[model samples]
Structure formats: C-alpha cells, structure tokens
Target: MTVTRFAPSPNGPLHLGHAFSAIVAHDRAARDGGEFLLRIEDIDGVRSRDELADEFRADLAWLDLEYRDVTPQSQRIERYRSAADDLLAMGLLYPCTCTRAEVASAAVAVGPDGPLYPGTCLRRGPTPGLDVAWRLDMEQAVDLAGPLEWTDERRGAQRATPAMFGDVVLWRKDAPASYHLAATLDDAADGVTCVTRGIDLFRATHVHRLLQHLLGLPVPVWHHHAVLVEADGRKLAKRRDAPALADRRRAGEDGRSVAAELRAALFDTGISLSDIINQQT
Candidate 1:
C-alpha cells in the first residue's frame, strides 16, 4: 500500500533530469505493488503554461509512465489556505514584512537569499496582517528530531542540519499557498507513503520535513536519486534545458534511442536500445 507520486511543475518541457526522476518513481511503485499518481504542481499561474503542462503529460505518456490519478496544485489552493489558517490559529505561523535586503542585512544570514531568520519577526509584535509571504514557526519543529533523515534508495541516508533551513515560506504575498504548503497537502490527501525523486531536491528534504511536522502529517520514506548531469557538470534547469522531449517530438523522433541515452546517463546501467524499444507499451 505504498502510494507514491511524480509531482512535477508543468512550467517547462521534460528533460533528461525529469526522465530519471520519473522512471525511479514509476519503477519503485511497480516494484512495491503501489498506486502511482501524477500531480501537476502548477501553483505559479503566472509562469505555468498549458503547452508546457501538456508537454509534461505527453512526454510521460511517451515514456509509458502513466499514473492512476492526477491532482493540480492550483486546483487545491483552498486546502492549503485552510491548513495555513489552522497553523495561524495555533500561534505557530507568522507574517514578516522584511524584504530580502533587510533580512540579509541582519547578522542572521544563511545563504544569498537571506539569513536563517534571527527571530526578528517572531517576536516583532502582534504578528502583522500577513500582507507578505508567511513562514511557519520552526520552533515547533525543533524538538521533532535530530536534523532530518531519509534514506534515498540511490544515495542512502542523507540529512540536513536544522540551522540550515529556518522558517521556510508557505504562502506568498499574492499567492495563497506556495509549493511547500501545497505539496504537503497533496501528499497527505493522496496517501503518498513514499516519494522517489531527483537528488537535486536533497535540500528540499529539510523544508518538506519541517512542513510535515508543522502540519502534523506523515513524512513518507524518501528516495532521492542522483541527477543526470551534463558533460560540464552543470545541472539541467527547465529554462534552457536540453534533451527536451518536446523538441524530439517536434523533430519526428520517437522510440528507443532517446530512452537508452537517458537510462545510460542516469544510472550508468548499460541498457540496450532494444530494452527501451520493447518497453514501449
């Protein structure tokens, strides 16, 4: 009964990186006799395009990676809102109006984005109108466990220090719910007991772990695989990414060769082109 999902943001075309993650997700589900689901993480309406969304579906279908159900995050904003409100009522959420500059100026800095919040807004008064992005109070999660631990099937146990990720955003200024909140809701609602995705998201495990504790939801067993890196050792991004299924489809390229290349790059497993050809079902 290991329900899993491949939740990709339909904001761009599927590339080699996406192919690795998708295969791992689908393969793990099949191995476990679990239900697999597809979730469209289209929360960013301004950037999410129908064509790109269609590309995600068409590409996955071409790879023969179909799911039992699909849930779009945009369609589930209310659920995120409700969850956020509940956290607010419990005095475990806060609204900080500090801009990127102001937060970065403080001695409490983590990365280029800003510092690990110095609790500047935590006790900054009556908890403002939430006019800006809202952050879940991390103090509630500090006692949950030591750092965060999850055994990625491909990479084994990987953990992140708590001090590294502090008070991550859950709701944006205009947008009600951000990816963190929506994704947490999706996993629980859809009964996702496990998650198999790219190792590129290893840092995301910290944010996701925090959300699970904050919302009182089950944290699934995570499996983050190594990504398909380019020859230059650079990671692929949706913007200007290559090996896009759309381009291949447009060029009238179909079938096995591409899958073989993808499989080879992903695991270094010398799968024959014929293996991919036969997998087309």
Candidate 2:
C-alpha cells in the first residue's frame, strides 16, 4: 500500500502552498487506494506553537483533507536521538560550532537552503556541553552509503549527492532535532511509501537518500510538485509574509471554494493530481 504524508511545521499558519501540497498528497493517496497521513513537524523547539498546530489541523479539515493518522515530530524526539546516536557511533557525525554569520562569511557556494555550510567544525571532536550542533560527515556518509539513487515522480531518477550541501546538521543547537534528522526518522517510522512536498525541497531529498541508506531504512518514491509562487516568482512561505489560508477563511470565503480554487490553479497549469502521480517536472 502506498502511504503518503503531508508534514507541515507548526511555526506558522497554513498558506496556499501548504494547501496545494496537502491536496496533492491527499488526492494521490485516494486515487491509489492508499493511506494519507498528516504529520505535525513541531520540533522547532519553543518556536513551535500548539495553537498553530491546532490551526493547521483545522485548516486541513476545512479543506476536507482527511488522513488516517497524525504524528508530531515533537513526540518522537527519542527516535531521532536514537538515529543520531547510531550515526555518531558509526563515526559518521561530528560536532559543529560554526555560527550562521561565520558560515556565510566562509561558505564557498550557496544552495537552496542558503549558504552551504563550510566544514569549519569537521575536525572538532564531540565535546561535553559546548552548545554545539551535530552534522553528518558528508564525505564519510556518502562513502558508507556507496552509490545510491532515489526516484521522483516529477524529476525522474536522482543520484544522491549530499556533499552538495556540505555537512548538513542532524541536530540544531536550539532544536531537539534538525529537520533533516527528524523528518527522515519520522517518515521511516510512519511507514510512508511515497514522499510528497513542494519542489523547493527537491534538493534536500539527496541528503535524505543518504540518511535512508546509512540508517538502513526503507526508501520511498518522492514527488516534488510545483510550488505556489507570487507574481514576483517568490515562493509562498511564512517568512515571506504570504497571506495565511486562515485569513481567507475568516474573510468569509468558503473553505471548500478556496481549496477548489487552489486545485484549479494547478489544473490550469496542465498538471492534475493524477499527473503528479505519473509525470516528471
């Protein structure tokens, strides 16, 4: 059975991009006679708000995006920590103490998630209570995983190239687990068979593929659907101040209508839910 999921962080209200990704995943699962699950990625430390997570659930309910189960990353810290421990034991991780400004000043290249972290702390041994982050030793991890590839419904076969992002962090200084660690662990735990999200995350999948291989977890097919963007071509994101879906709902727009409009916008681009399941970007 194809188990798909729409995992959204609870740091902000839902927006059109969230709606689109949720609807696509929900529809694909329904069409394939599979299970659709909702996950609250609330592992952003204290920045995660329960009220916003509740609002996210309400927004999905309003859109009629039902699911079989709901899981929260905050509730699975132990699992993530366990995975990190396993990697650390394998000598595939190292402590990183580089600050953002320091990394930006030293980074040789910038990728989708901002400046790729330079390996400043690569040689630093894990210390006791130094307020350091844990980062995957990308070169070592890739060597351990060997040659690997993953499938994407939109982008076809993809070679795992985690080194492109440098040593990506598995644990953040302020969060229980970084998005990379928490998300990869949760997806495996939930038995997700198909991973669906906006195309902006397409690159991150390379790192995830490496994690899956290193952790000996099941690899799932991915679908990187087109992201909703503004007239200026900037993708809709909370940090960018994209209008919240709840605001539209409060303004008396019928929830279903708004959802339909979002769906229609995708359809107008010649991509339907079925196409998402079978086509490439």
Candidate 3:
C-alpha cells in the first residue's frame, strides 16, 4: 500500500505553509487508500517544546487531516544511535567538534543548505575533551555506495550527489541524531512509500538517497511541491514568525473551508483531491 508522512518539528506553532504540506501528504495517502503517518521531529533538544506537539495534532484535527500512525523522535534515540554506530563501524562516520561560526569562517564553497563545512575536523580530528558530533565521510560513503539514483514524482529520476554537501553531520553533540540520519531512518522504519514534502528540501534528498544505499534501507518515491511564500517571496518559516494557524482557529474560521482555499491556491485551480493525485501519478 502507498504510505506518506507529515513530519513536523515542534519548535513553533503550525502555520499555513505547514498546513499546505500536511494536507498534501494526507490527501496523497488518502487518494490511494493508504496510511498517512504523523511524526514529531522533536530532537532539537531544549528548543523542542513538548506542548507544541499536542498543538500540532489539534491543528491537524482542525484541518480534518487524520493520520493513522504517529512517531516521536524522542522515543527513537536508540535507533538513531545504532544507525550511527553501524556507519562508524563501516568507516563512514568521523567525530567532529566544529562550531557553526568556525565552519562559516573557514568555508570557501556553498552548497544547497548554505556555506558547506570545510572539513576542518575531518582533517584535524576531534579536539580532546570537546563534545563531538559525528559527520559522514561523504567521499568515502559515495565511493562505497557507488553511483545511485532516486525518483521524484515531479522531477523524475535524479542522480544522487551527496558530495555537494561535503561531510554532513549524522549525529550531533546536542542531539541524538542530525536530521539527515534521523528522518531517513524514520521513513524507512515507518514504511513510507512516497515522501511528500516541500521543494526547498529537494536537494537534501540526494544525501538521503546515499544514506539509504549505505544503510540498506528501502528507497521511497518523493514528491516535492512548491513551498508557500509570503508577499516578499520569502518562504514562510517559524523562525521568521509566520502567521500561526492557531490564530485562525481562535478567530472561528471554518477549518475545512480554509483547507479548500489552500488546495485551490497551491494547485492553481479548483482541482479535486483525486484530480491532483491523477495529475501527479
């Protein structure tokens, strides 16, 4: 059966952009009579508010999105750690103590996420007594995985190029797992057949494909839809303090009507859910 998930971090309240992404995933699974899963990606340590998770569920409920399963990253730390250990045993992971400021100052080239790490710790090794994060040895990992590819519903087949991000972190000193490791493992564990998320993360799929190849995980088809943006053209984000969905709910807006409006806005027509799925498939 087809499966899809809406994985949200609980650092802030749900916004319209998040609603759009969640609705897309929920409807995609519904269209195929498949399971829709919700995952709380709350591994950011103290920044992750426990209460926001409950709020996320309420918001989704308000939007009439029903998820059959839910997984919280906090409960899966051991799994992430085991995956890191396996990579380390395979000589694919190395310890790093580089700080963001240090990396930014040393980096010469930029990648999809931003200024790529310059591999200072990869060259120097972790400093003694300093807490260290684990980074993937991208060159070694890609060499071991060999040439790889993953498919996207919208973009078609894509050649995996994880090297563009250089040696990305897999485990963080402050958290059990970096997003690259945790999200990849969680999707495999949840049996997500189709990964539906925003297009901003489309590049990260290259790294995820390599992780799947290395870890012997099942690869999933992806659908990266265009992100909701503000009038200034900047994508809505929690850090930027995007308008919260809770505000609309408090103001007594009709949730289903709001959802329908979002669907029309995103698809650029009054397309039915089945029509959207048909066009993509």
Q: How much lDDT does each candidate structure score?
A: 0.70, 0.82, 0.86
Q: List model 1 lDDT by residue over 175-199, tens digit each.
A: 7687667877888888888887766
The CA lDDT at 110 in model 3 is 96
Q: Worst lDDT window (10 residues) for model 1?
A: 268-277
Error of 1 at 221 (Å): 0.7
**Per-residue alpha-carbon lDDT of model 3 for 126-218, expressed as tens digits?**
653448888899999999999999999988999998999999988888888989999999999999999999888999999999999989999
Clashes of 2: 1
Error (Å) of candidate 3 at residue 122 is 2.0
The superposed Cα distance between candidate 3 and the true structure at residue 226, in angstroms, equals: 0.8
RMSD of each candidate relative to the true structure: 4.5, 4.8, 4.9
CA deviation > 4 Å runs, candidate 1: 111-114, 144-151, 155-161, 268-281
- Where is model 3 more than 4 Å wrong at Cα? 127-130, 268-281
Model 2 score (lDDT): 0.82
